[model samples]
Target chain A: MIETSHLSFTIGDSQILRDVSLSILPGVVTGLIGPNGAGKSTLLHCLAGLTEPSSGHVRIDGQDPFTARDDDRARMVAFLQQSPTTVSRLRVEELVAFGRWPHHRGRPGPEDAEQVAKALDAFDLEELAGRPIETLSGGQKQRAFVAMTYAQDTPWILLDEPLNALDPRHARNLMARLATLANEEGRSIAVVLHDINAAARWADQIVAMKDGQVLAHGASRDVLTSDTLYACFDTPFDTVPHAGRKLVVAT
Target chain B: MRPWVGIGLVLIVMILASLAVGAASISDGDGGWLIWVSRFPRTAAALLAGAGLALAGVVIQNVVQNRLVEPTLTGTPEAAMLGLLGVTLIAPGLAVAGKMLIAAGCALLGMVGFLALARRISPRDPMLLPIVGLIYGGILGAIATYVAWQTDLMQFLGIWQLGEFSAVMQGRYEWLWAVAALAFGLYLIADRITILGLGETQARSLGLGYEQTRAIGLVIVSVLTAIVLVTVGAFPFVGLVAPNLASRWQGDNLRANLPIIALGGAMLVLGADIIGRLIVYPYEIPAATLVAILGAGVFLWLLHAAPRRA
Candidate 1:
């Protein structure tokens, strides 16, 4: 479980996160959604231990991420930040292998190789394994990076906008992958997402934020309502039943 | 069959040429004295400086996450020159090692200053950094030049500013062996250095101590720059051109590619030094001049090739 208690973060005079307390349950997919400047990214950074909050405390699996050594924190939590560096000249497989760094550090054994190969196969990146990341298209590149995050083999996986460059099909495919990882593997997953319908379809829980505060947080069915969406995004939102599920659309 | 094997052969030939071809040619029965005293030291200095500068280039480029920026462009060499000038004026009786420490310190400060300035620029655009480096380096160089002029130490400045090995001898150039030691130390942590290219958040996520690794790289670059400047003077683009060529041929697997980059740098400098010696036939053009011309060409090609290569 990743828990933040009464968290407030400020950069100089501008506050990025307010007195926000949130609980992210283990073995579930939690989708974080809001408009721009919603503090979703900041909160993710805090959870990842890449940022220290000005006030309040963050505990990941009962230990403070801030105080844990970088390697130990990485062993426990794998975070993919928004727009992570698109390194050129590195083949897809080698890039994914970097996820194993926290495990082997530099000396890679047979087990590390097995994990890397498993990660590549899991993400269906076996075909592009030898290809350089720069040569891949947007969706393929996004898949490669997601595969790297998967390769981290951490119990908690936090991704900030993993679907930015992906097309609709790829985005749905990625969400399906995350949902499977959370449901079947029992790993906790938190993702910052822009697509409301994807969150509605795939996420078990949802957190809606606006102006640096959590406006709504609960199970998807409870929190992903038209009123909550409208309140969070400052726009008119309509939720209509489509087939067996509800679709969130801005009017 | 491997590229490095071919490069090794080429390097050997270059070393032989460097030792054999000089202003004072060795006669049949010279008994290795000239080779040990002058030619050997000069050849070794060239190789060490080239390798050192190349690794420095790799570190700076990875740290900044831009291929175009190198130590010379980062105000390091200019700062070292300024430090050396200060030492010359204030404490002429100080030891060479003392002067080097001061210069290395100044180079680190200069690099930190540039890094702070770099924080302001949008890092997404890689081209902007080289321009910023050039301007920042130019301002530093101008200040150094003005200081040298005021102090009438322009001749002293030229010896350190324009890198050449004609004056190299055994006892004088032995300190350059530090480059070899530094390069070996860099090899051990090359993976961490490579991780730096991933940018801060990703690198840290990968369990790298991002600030610590970056600090280590900057210190190494500063020390290497100061060592080269104080020992055999400054060479412009050994760091830039060597690492780019290695990356182009071998890719960004820096742990495995470190030797290739170092050797690539050594070859370029050794080759340039030979050409400099042979082109003027004993009169000798500065290896610095030749390398600047060649390095600038490679740099321009890199700028033109960045978008196309991707």
Candidate 2:
């Protein structure tokens, strides 16, 4: 389980997150939805130990994730930043192999290579393994990066704006993969998604935020209501039932 | 186009040409012993220094994650030049090895200082770091030029400025071999250095000590720059050109490209040296001048040929 206790953050003169507290359970897909500049990414960064909080603390499985060793933290939580800085000139396989760095350091044995191969297969990247990352299309590159994060094999995966450059097909495929990982593999995933319906249809839990604070958070059944959506984004939303589930439609 | 194969072919051709041409051309050997003692070492010096400079440039580019970075442009070569100047002034009779040692030490210090300044300003901006380095290089070059002019050491400094393999003979060229060995050490640690190119956060998350690897890379660059300074003075952008060429084929995996880049560097220097010798005959232009002209032309071509991201 991942827990954040009164975690607050400020940069320069602006407060990005304020005394926010939340707990995420295992085997659930937690969707973080918020308006622009709502501190969703910032909070994600803090949880992944990419940035230090101003006060309070974040813990993953009872250990301060921020201060934990790289290998330990990597094993517990895998973080995929929005628009990850790609290392150009590297092959897709080589980039994926880096996900195993925390485990193998520089020397890779047969087992590590096997895991890399599995990740490539899992993300449908085997065909593009030898191709340089720079040669891939935007969607392909995003898949390569996702494959890398998946190759890390952490129990809790955190992604920020993962669907930005992906097309509908790729986006839906990725969400399905995440859903499968959550249900079959019994792992937790926290994703900051822009598509409300995608979240409503796939996410087991939803946490809404506006202006650096949580507006509403609960099971998808309660959190995906039109009132909560409007309050979170300051825009009107209509709800419709589809396949016996709530789908939020923007007005 | 496989850059490694191209570089190897060029290096081989240059090696053959270097052995064949000189003041005492292989066709008419004034003394067999003279060729062995003098010309052979000079050729070796050019080859070693060229390879070292190229490898150093590759490492620096990877560390700073910028293509524009080079030892001469990054202030290290100028700092080394100053070290040579200081040694010449303080101990006029100092041997070439002593001068190179002083140059290496000073270059290391200069590189460290530059990195510290870069970190303070903007660690993430690749362009900013190289600009600061270029400015620093200019200041050091100015100081060296002024001092050389005042002390009537202008001719000596000028010869150093326009790199020539003529100064290198068997006995005087051992320093370059040491530099080549240092370059090999860099190759051994190339993986660690490449990891650093991924930015600090990513590198650290991968269990690498970013600061330490960066420092080690800088130190290696300093030593390479210093050796090149003492061996052939300053040679425009062989360092810049070779690595980019290597990257075109090898894709930034330093370990895979090390030999290719080294050979490419050797080919560039030797070919320039040979062309200089052939064009002017008895009145040879400096090898450094030829390198500048050739390197710039090739660099322009690379600008067109370079892949978008590599």
Candidate 3:
């Protein structure tokens, strides 16, 4: 479990994240939804221990992630930033293999290769394994990055705007894969998503934010209500049930 | 692999030709002692300097996350020159080693400054970093030039500015051997260096001490540049050309590509030196001038070549 207590982040004179406390449970897909500049990405970075909170603390499995050793933090949380830069001429398989770095630290063992191969297969990247990441299409590159994060084999996986470049098909496929990983492999995933309908349909829980503070956090059905959506986005949103899942639409 | 074999053969021919063609022909009866004293040392100096600069280029590129920028373009050589000028004026009696230590320290400081500036700019325009570096180097070079002129050390400055192997002798160039040890150390951490090219967040998330690794890389680059500047002066373009060619032929897997990059650097510099020897036949031009001419051409070609893969 990942928990934050009165977390706040400030940069110079501006407050990016206000005092916010939340819990991310294991074995579930939690979606973070907010408008632009709502501190969704900053919050995600804080949880990944990539950014330090100004006045509060975050704990992952009872250990402070901000203060943990690098290897220990990496073993517990894997983070995929939005639009992660690619190293030129780095092959897809090699990129995925880097996910095992915390485990091997440069020297790879048989288990590392096995995990890398499994990640490639999981993301359907086998055909593009030997290709350079720069040569892949946007969707393919996104898949390669997702596979790299998956190969980290961490208990908590955090992604910021991973679906930005993905097409609808690839986006749905990725959400399904994350759901399966959460359900079967028991990984806790917190993904910052721009697409509210996708979050409503796939996310086990939803956290709504606006102006650096959480407005609502609960089961998808409870948090996806039109009133909460309006309070979070300052825009009217209609939520309807479709095939036993809530579908959110701008109205 | 076959192409590499071909390149190896070409390099061997060039080395032999460089050893044979000099002010004094190796066909002379006294050629054995002359080759041992001057020709071999000169060749070794050129090779080591080339390999070191090329390796330094790769590390700097990865650390800065910019392919177009190298130490030569990034004010490193000029900063080292300034340090050398300072030591020359303050402690003219200092040994070459002392001078090198001071120069390396200054170069490290300059690189850190460049990196700090680089952090503020976006890497979206690949050409921007090199341009910034060129201007930075120019300002430093102007300061060094003013100091040299004021101190009446312009003659020494000229020699440092135009890197050449003509002055290298058995005892004069042994300090460059430090580059070999530095390169070996870099190889041991090649994987970490490659990981660094992934940028800050990913590298940190992968458990790398990103700032620490960048500092170590800068130190290596500074030391390498200092050694070369102290020994052969500044040879522009070898660092940029060698690593760029190697990356095009192979990939960015540092461990797998470093040897090839080193060899390519050695060959290019040695080839330039040989051409300098034979082009005028005993009235030799400086190898540094020849490399600048060739390196500039290649650098231009690289700029106009196909769009970058990244």
Q: What is the DockQ of candidate 3?
A: 0.71
Better of 1 and 2 by lDDT: 1
lDDT of 1 at A223: 90
Name the TM-score of candidate 3: 0.98
Tens digits of lDDT, candidate 1, B101-206: 9999999999999999899988778888878988998999999999999999999888988999899998998888999999999999988887898889999988
Better of 2 and 3 by DockQ: 3
Q: What is candidate 3's lDDT per residue for A123-175, written digit by digit as tens?
A: 99999999978778889998998899999999999999999999999999999
When summed lDDT is taken over every stretch of 10 residues in candidate 3 chain B, the lowest stretch is B301-310
The 10-residue segment with the lowest total lDDT in model 1 chain A: A82-91
Two-way TM-score contest, 2 vs 3, winner: 3
- lDDT, candidate 2, B70-139, per-residue tens: 7876788888888888889889898777887899899998787677776676445545665688799889
Q: Which stretch of 10 consecutive residues in model 3 chain A shows the poorest summed lDDT? A: A82-91
Q: What lDDT does the true structure give each of the candidates? A: 0.89, 0.81, 0.90
Backbone clash pairs in model 2 (N, Cα, C under 3 Å; residues 3+ apart or in different chains), count: 0
- Output the lDDT of residue A43, model 3: 95
